[model samples]
Target: MPRLPIIHKTQLVASSRLFQVEEVHLEFSNGEQRIFERLVSRGYGAVLIVPMLDNETVLLIREYSAGTERYELGLPKGKVEPGEDLFEAANREIMEEVGHGAHHIQLLKRVSLAPGYMGHHTNLLLARDLYPATQPGDEPEPLEVVPWKLNRLDELIAGNECTEGRSLLALYMVRDLFMRLNR
Candidate 1:
């Protein structure tokens, strides 16, 4: 196995209200040194929730995605407020976006979109036993809550505008989890 590279230095090159780009200098074990640029989040990590509306149904949200320049369908997600619990953040986001809160929440996994150049981590959560709830959210416009069947995830991907990788992957993971548990 190869040893991890040593970080020589890291410098902030750019900053924005939502992101920070940093330049990282690294030296390999074999005397190879390189400088790489990556993103550094200014806050704690985020949470992506798969809010289950029923045994076979999951609640998704359709919201405008500036990165893709269109509305995308995916699970409710938000940043973890400083010092806030990850599960609490997931429940809060689901309630604010989907008009429901979960009584049971399980951590699915933590994922990185592009670990090669991005430093953001989103903890995936599976939320169940939901009840009607809502709180004011920071979204500029109200989101459309979509109910999707766990067995029809392929249709959700093939026919709908669902495109967030983390949400898609988490949905599949939760579905498989249900399958394994049911068996």
Candidate 2:
């Protein structure tokens, strides 16, 4: 692997309730220098849960997204709170968003959103053996839980409401995983 660029300086460029932007000054080994801005991640990180309703169905949620200003259909996801392990956070988010808790949970992978400009990594988890459960979430309104068949992922991705890249990638990963396991 190549050596990483040296960060000469960093400054907080902006801040908000849920996000912080930082400007980084870097010097490369080849005598190149540049400044870049990134959204500084806060807290332990986050968990995106691909909750399986069955071997064929995955649970998704339709909730309002302030960033897109529309209702997005995606997997249940939330930050991993202080002291909460990834599995605990995954289960909690599923309970809060999809009204179910998983008896079997496995960490699939860790993914970054815009790794070039965002210092955030989300744990992608696969949750199975679901049971009915609900916990009040911090959402302003109730989330609509949608169970989607894994076999029809292409149709779901074709829809406009399911545009989040992270969610789409997680679904594909889960589908591939199940296929390999069944084989």
Candidate 3:
């Protein structure tokens, strides 16, 4: 394995409400130096929940994505609040976006969207044994909850609205796990 680069210093090149641009100065073991710019998120990470309404159906949400400037169809997800557990954040996000709460929830994986250029991480959560519930959320508009069959994930992926990489990979992972378990 190659040695990790030593970070000489990191400077804040830009700042925004939700993200900060950082310039990292580093020196490798070979005495080579390089400067890389990355986006540093300003919160405790986040959680992306796959709330299974049944053995086959998963609850999804359609909401406006500011980055895309349009509505996106994806699994319920939200940021982890300060001092909050990842599972707790997952349940809360589902309740807020899908109007449901999970009786059982487990972390599947923690992933970085763009590890090479971003410091943000999202915890993928698998939620089952769901019940109807709703919590007030900070969304500017009410979200549309859509029940989707895991078997039809290909259709969802082929659609343009399900463009979030984290959501697609999470669903694929859960689908594969469920298929293997049922075999």
Q: Please write out the lDDT profile of model 2 over residues 18-56, one tens digit for every residue.
A: 889999999988879999999998889999999999889
Residue 22 error, candidate 3, Å: 1.3
Off by over 4 Å in 3: none
Clashing pairs in 2: none
In model 1, the clashing pairs are none
| Global lDDT of each candidate | 0.92, 0.93, 0.92
**After TM-score superposition, what is the CA distance of residue 73 in candidate 2 from its true location, in Å?**
0.6
How do the residues 75-112 of candidate 3 rate in per-residue lDDT, one tens digit apiece?
Answer: 88988898889988999999999989999999999998
Q: State how far residue 144 of model 2 sits from its true place (Å).
A: 0.8
Check candidate 3 and list the clashing pairs.
Answer: none
Error of 3 at 14 (Å): 1.0
Give stretches of model 1 more than 4 Å off: none
